[model samples]
Target: MKNLRNALLLKQLYQLKQLGYKYTSVTPYKEDEQHLRLPNTLDSLKKQAMECHLCELSKSRQKVVFGEGDPQADILFIGEGPGTMEDSSGKPFVGRSGELLTKMIENVLLISRSEVYITNIVKCRPPNNATPTPTQAHTCQPYLLKQIELIRPKIIVTLGVTAYHYLTGDDTEISKVRGTLHKQNDYTVIPTYHPSYLLRNPSAKKEVFEDLLKVKELMGK
Candidate 1:
């Protein structure tokens, strides 16, 4: 189908973009070969990500921070990208913000942190803890997409405007949709404030609490 071919081309473009290629010509592929391009397993995907040098962030990163948690988790939390602590420790949400997130998960969701998966929009850390540029995010998106496909999480929580915007291609302010439920493909998406935001603006904690409650309700907790 033409639509399928176009979609396949788009995926290849993302891959090329990751490799820091500005432009390239794509040859048509037989449908059978299309599936072979993506790694079929999470381990393989993570391995691919670990060795990735597709974007500028890779130049400054200490580790890939590919993500961690139960392989078949029902919920996945996506943040913007690695911060100073995360960059140094090679883990997601391991800083002050991470501590808050852990408490939110355990206390509000009534689940252990290890029970769910956690990752970021981009695996590498941006210099000076700045937000990832559009090119950087676009390049790393394929990896995240593959992770979602392999993990097949039932719910995806997009933390902050960056995660929400990149995942849904919607630039709406996070406050307006913080606790809203959205159907995206086969998964339920819940947008909420990043824990780092809570650290700076503790007043927002109540709103995040409400959002987590919704997540709990959806999970039948």
Candidate 2:
């Protein structure tokens, strides 16, 4: 029975990939024609992300925050895109939202924020905090996929509708997505509201915290 269920699950995942839902991107992050040595780890991803011209974002970007945190972390947090502070610092989630994320991370599993990898679906900061268009996402996605495959994280926590949408292609609302674990490309995925969202609506923290607890349980922490 377990084997049958597993087969069914694998079939569904393949269907999603075939339909351009969840996929493993193999393309380089850029077509620079000037190859930069990409590190096999997150640290190297940052270097490539900065020089990446996979999309027009590189043209106006101040910094392409590749990612940060423990490379071998069991947990990975993926966000929608970079914001002002992130761009300025060339780091992901360094603002108030990052602070909230840090606290939430600590609350779950006794792990510090520095102990888990944090990145975004799109590496570069979108113009004026705008959302990443489909074309941009297409260009940047391969890099993210590479990161996931390299880290082989045990859990992926997507923060916001955009990240969830691109990963699962299900237009389900964030409220519906949060607190429920989903599998994508063989990774355990759970979507939740962006920390920035929780800051605006503190009531949502309850929901975010609950989601964190789920991650804790999954980690056996």
Candidate 3:
């Protein structure tokens, strides 16, 4: 009986390891509950983020764009990463693409940009605004995950394939996955084309608008 029990315990630990969870004194199952109980104020999270060096992106970042908007917002917009303008100002969504995003919020959602929280997969800008490598994103993913846990938004609108892939771990292209409603953790995720893509191909804006309307509908519920 003792040997059988020991074998079962080893199997349980192995299963936890396979699921990417570290068994500690506190146990892996309580990780989310513990994080939920932590101080989730934006100011506190931003202060910690300012000192973060979890990934190489931090080494080259001019500024860590932690994110900005209503802390208690029911909606969150996540982008790929900081752009040149956002890096310059230490804010998210302030460039040409940001302008488009703001317009969409106003025109489609009938809400001001300030009404929703906006952030990115990685807090720092990638070199020359390239897509963030998977390693960098994985290293910095905890912060975004914490933000989501705190905000507990009704809807999460992921702009671009990077954000979609980061949150859902789904490699589907944005063109293929856009407009589909996916459930991640405890929130509804809606993937759509990034504003930069819409800038290059204005025709895709119609599709993004359709996605945004879905966000509006979900938020209403």
Better of 1 and 2 by lDDT: 1
lDDT string for model 2 (13-90, tens) is: 554566897565543223232342345766666666676775678888888888888887789999989999999898
TM-scores of the candidates are 0.85, 0.81, 0.82
Better of 2 and 3 by TM-score: 3
Cα error, candidate 3, residue 71 (Å): 0.6
Give the top-scoring candidate (TM-score).
1
Instruction: Encode model 3's per-residue lDDT on 1-221: one tens digit a residue.
Output: 12223323444565556778775453322223433332457688788789877567788889999999998899999999999999989999997999999999999999999999999998999999999876667666767887887888988999999999989989998899999998877889999999999999999999999999999998773
Tell me the spans in candidate 3 whose CA falls farther than 4 Å from its real position.
Answer: 1-39
Misplaced by over 4 Å in model 2 are 1-39
Cα-based RMSD of the predictions, in order? 4.6, 8.8, 8.0
Report clashes for each candidate as comma-separated counts.
1, 0, 0
**lDDT at 8, model 2:** 32
* Candidate 3, residue 73: how far the Cα is off, in Å: 0.9
Quick one: ranking by lDDT, best first? 1, 3, 2
Model 3, residue 139: what's the lDDT?
60
lDDT of each: 0.88, 0.79, 0.84
